[model samples]
Target: MSERDDEEREFDLKWADGAEQKEPSARARMLAARWKENPPGPVPFRADPEHVGSRRRSSWVSTAVVLGCVAAVIVLLGYINFRAPY
Candidate 1:
């Protein structure tokens, strides 16, 4: 084989053997240790006061839109099924 072919084969074989394991960096280890010692507090369940009204309003709007679409489909199907033949 030529030099290039031999080099390519060596490269493929080296990667095919799988990667080597690596130790975590000092900063990563320090952060992990700190979190272990003092974990974060639980997340809040309630929405913020300013956002609460908007969230509720948007949810109601979305629900009304879905119900409107469903009602339209139902009416269209009923008219198609029961309408007189032309």
Candidate 2:
């Protein structure tokens, strides 16, 4: 309101809270255009020979671990229920 108040506040009210948006950079716009022109195809399976072996090994190991955990839980529950005087 006063001359001192104007000096204390220099910010404009036009874009006080709104963000200043900007267009994408040249490289980003070029990549977007290229992607639209040549969209990617469906991903291929077993693309690498090294990955194929590890992937198969991991599945087998995971299955064995899951089965072992389930068996242990069932055995523990059965032992606990049998020993309990109900």
Winning model by lDDT = 1
lDDT of each: 0.90, 0.84
Over 4-73, each residue of candidate 1 has an lDDT whose tens digit, in order, gives 9999999998986666875788999998999999987887898679998998999999999999999999
User: Candidate 2 has what TM-score?
Assistant: 0.49
Q: Mind giving the per-residue lDDT tens digits that candidate 2 earns over 2-74? A: 9777765544434453558857889999989998999877887647787889989999999999999999999
lDDT for 63 (candidate 2): 100
Worst 10 residues of 2 by lDDT: 10-19
Angstrom error of the Cα, residue 65, model 1: value is 0.7
What are the runs in model 2 whose C-alpha is more than 4 Å off?
Answer: 1-46
Give candidate 1's TM-score.
0.44
Give the number of colliding residue pairs in candidate 1.
0
For model 1 the local lDDT of residue 82 reads 90
| Alpha carbon lDDT at 49, candidate 2 | 86
- What is the Å distance of residue 11 in model 1 from its true position? 46
Model 2 C-alpha lDDT versus the unseen true structure: 0.84
